[model samples]
Target chain A: MHALATLIALSLASPAAPLDWHPDLSSAEAAAEESGRAMLIVFR
Target chain B: MVRPTTLLSLVASRFECVRVTDMAGVDLDRHRFDFDLTSCILLQRADGHRYHTFGGRTWEGAESHLSVPALVRVLVRTLEEHEKAELPPRGRSGPGRTVEALPPLARRIEAGRRPACIHCHSVHDWQVEAAKEAKRWRPQDGWVFPDPREFGFSVDPIEQERVVSVEARVEGLQVGDRILAIEGTPVLTFGDIVLALDRSGDGPSVRMRLLPVSGGPSASPVERVVSTSRGWREPDPLLYSWRAMKWNLDPSPGFGGPQLTARELGGLGLAPGTFAFRVQYLVDGGARAETGRSAARAGLRVGDVVLSLDGRSDFRSVDHVHAWFRLTRRAGETVILEVLREGERRRIDLPVVGLGR
Candidate 1:
């Protein structure tokens, strides 16, 4: 319950504007592999 | 982060930046996390081998967080390492599909909200809750993001991967030496150290392989086993990762800081050398009956200044108080806490619980 509540609070706390974040994880991984780059996972 | 703004395009072009949509379900078991913080960053390869993990801040202000310059430096180094074919795959397996996917709070939530990524912190909470259910969790378990500094060595956070110093008894390692492998695992960056220690978990000694930072295969590598003292994996109390233990009052015990100054300690009848933590924030774990068992059972107040535990006050720092309590004491054990509530020093016995209990 604490986990869910904190999640809800985080969703509500997000700023009005959405940043240009990757839409999905798999696509990001695919992009990284094709580009020969690393994956940066930002948890906020 | 401001400095990273100018380099944002550079990072975007060089790496895949992802904010995983839903990390609560399957992803919970996929990636292993150490600290429970509001914000963290993990760097890994496309093959699922991790590079480095950083970014837990105290949030006092902009100064409290990591600098953009530091972040950029690390990015530049990681990119270079990748181009040179130095980064390796580590701890890689499936995408957690076969792992236990249900979070602790899953049954309490509406079905529609079950898979949602409410908060990144939920990942840590669920992992802790799950560990507790299986009776494998420990109080010192949250020190998952251990720092080399805690071990008396400082590694260049970026490409050099060189040791800055040997502060403690890191046998056979010294300044100017670079780490090659830890516990037989090939490691290239500080992120690798984080991953290694996270996987190490409550071990008695830390074994590391070292090489000359002067960069020549001509020199043979040396192996060193750094026998640790108690609380070896515990990050220093002042670190952003340590804040993962901050003050909370619900589904789990929350730890917070803004340690008491000498004046505050004096006000609480402590001496100039006293170490105490002033709780400034409250983490409401989740919903619980107001009258039932909960944080209220602990009888600790937000402003209460903790002086010692079980008559032990020889702790190293304010944060060390909590680390010592959690690391040394076992679950269901009673710790006699000497605290000052509104200038009145009283002893309170706190029943200890493991990390997420």
Candidate 2:
């Protein structure tokens, strides 16, 4: 129970990982293709 | 960066995020969006086949249609759609064309005025320049990324896909309708609707599939159509005048000023809604000086009160007059300007000349 509590506490205390933002389309497309993930390209 | 950590993390885990700030060397053929948008989000496959898009702004403001909740909803919905869909080919099937590949923009770059970072709107400006140079630009070409409001409906900003209201002119669509598809193209976000409408061409009407919100979760989607005799995609001059691409359009009327006050209109014997504006300043110098010079040569002097252009006096403002001229008239045309000069009515012929850059 104590170990479970510690894991729960750690999960709650941990901040969400920030998005791994690729700087350009080519690199992002490559990463996406390799990972079998769709791309979210934000043009700002 | 988007936040509320948990939601953003969900997005981060499921999608490859890319933040692009410059248009230099970006593929134009693969990525299509409204060049006027300051910030636009495109969702696509690894090989650049578009799945959905999520960004738009209005003259009311850029953030009016955007919110964290709406974006999260779009991301989640896109993921759901992706899972159940047949995926396209994993790689680009055809060659790519970059923004620099545009012939007119290439010439400008060759001239050494290449910007360190080309803005999204600059691509549109270059296209307009190219079209004008080629004598292929139509007045309707200025109308782009047609707003849903132009068609008499507005969606819930938070839900993004749920209809919140419909203008009385729009028949068969209710206030609480949830859009399923536009002309058989499934739409999960406002950007999808926009792209669908843009691809709908200059058709007089559009068909939509809507799931009525009032019908509950078990309700089946129904087909509805909205149409207009006046081009539904045509933009209001007041709204369209602010677009940066207008600078590349022709017939830049030289002079502009505040609309004539009611008292001034009364004194001039003009009706309240007449296009009466005093010439405050004329474009006399710089790259656009020829426009002002053209007006001056035609006897349009500073302080002259412009009453009408080509017998039309229903302009909402001086900006409207200029927008109307640019979108409706072309170079090699002559505009008859009726001005109240020194309390006397005089007509002058102003030649609409191209401001070739």
Candidate 3:
């Protein structure tokens, strides 16, 4: 019983999946120019 | 029987300094204490002393009805009287002969720890999850985290891609550039581009299959090879030691000074409503290396008041100076410097250094 409870707790503690962005170059370029600062587009 | 009366009398005497008024329409007769947004008063007796509570959900003390100043005065007086009563006569010989003292107990017992910024202040039981989420949302707030791209190259849908082809349009590509293949393998989404780039063997050039930005059969399927520069691998906006790039212009005479004093680098003394001096970093150096030592060697010393740079009258923050330097000056070039140091006025000539990454 303790093991089962511990397993449930561990499952709850797990982090959510990372957020993803849809690739769109035009929008990306527009955002970079709008900010008037350098933009970094990172892919995981 | 008399002890309760004496304690009540003593507490009432302490509260004499504060203005007290009876609160009507409150169940003071039943619960002996009633509190509202503005004030609270206790009429009940516990252990012979009437307890008065106040200040929102967190009652400061049983005697919370008293104002802060009144409470402090009463506490100090009580401590002083207690000490006097406990002390022995001057001739007495023992620990009590000198003076009786209260052990070190906090006069104000905070109910809970205070909140503090992780970057600037220390706090207890800081919420790791909340802090981490905040940092992830605004990673720039953290000193250790580097910005995503050094050259400010951020992409929409920020993901890696294998270039199917490289083409430069005079007007620039207007979207619809697709990857046909990576190293001759069929490519699909942007994810394939990153995977292919990773798997591509160590080489100076990578060959990629390209599709035309315009949706039509290419006159001919093109295989494009792009060359990567070794120097390009070096981080742009190079990091320089902050101690090497200090310059100041004095605004005392308000920009039209015939002479400027040059003093040793003194601490930044900013006053309210005063114009600020600019601290420029060497374009080659990153923000961290942009401090006094790098400044001193770069012809800037303590106590040099900045007046103007690059036709800008306001050079207040370190960032302002850095932006001006990058936009106006080039490496190995001399820039005009008007500074006030050591009570003497002089115009010193200084050379610009390349930024380090």
Q: Which candidate wins on DockQ?
A: 1
Per-residue lDDT tens digits of candidate 2, residues B199-267? 777776789888987789888988888675456767776566656666666668877888889998898
Candidate 1, residues B111-174, lDDT tens digits: the string is 5555434565555666666676777765555655556666666665344357777766555566
What's the TM-score of each model vs. the native? 0.65, 0.77, 0.25
Fnat of candidate 1: 0.57
Lowest summed lDDT window (length 10), candidate 1 chain B: B56-65
**How good is model 3 by TM-score?**
0.25
Candidate 3 Cα errors over 4 Å, as ranges: A1-44, B1-155, B158-174, B180-206, B216-222, B225-299, B303-333, B338-347, B351-357
Model 1's DockQ? 0.28
Better of 2 and 3 by DockQ: 2
Docking class of 1: acceptable
- DockQ, each predicted model: 0.28, 0.28, 0.01
Residue pairs with colliding backbones in model 2 are none
Fnat of all models, as shown = 0.57, 0.66, 0.00
How should the candidates be ordered by TM-score, best one leading?
2, 1, 3
Candidate ranking under lDDT, highest first, comes to 2, 1, 3
RMSD of each: 7.6, 8.2, 29.5
TM-score head-to-head 2 vs 3, winner? 2
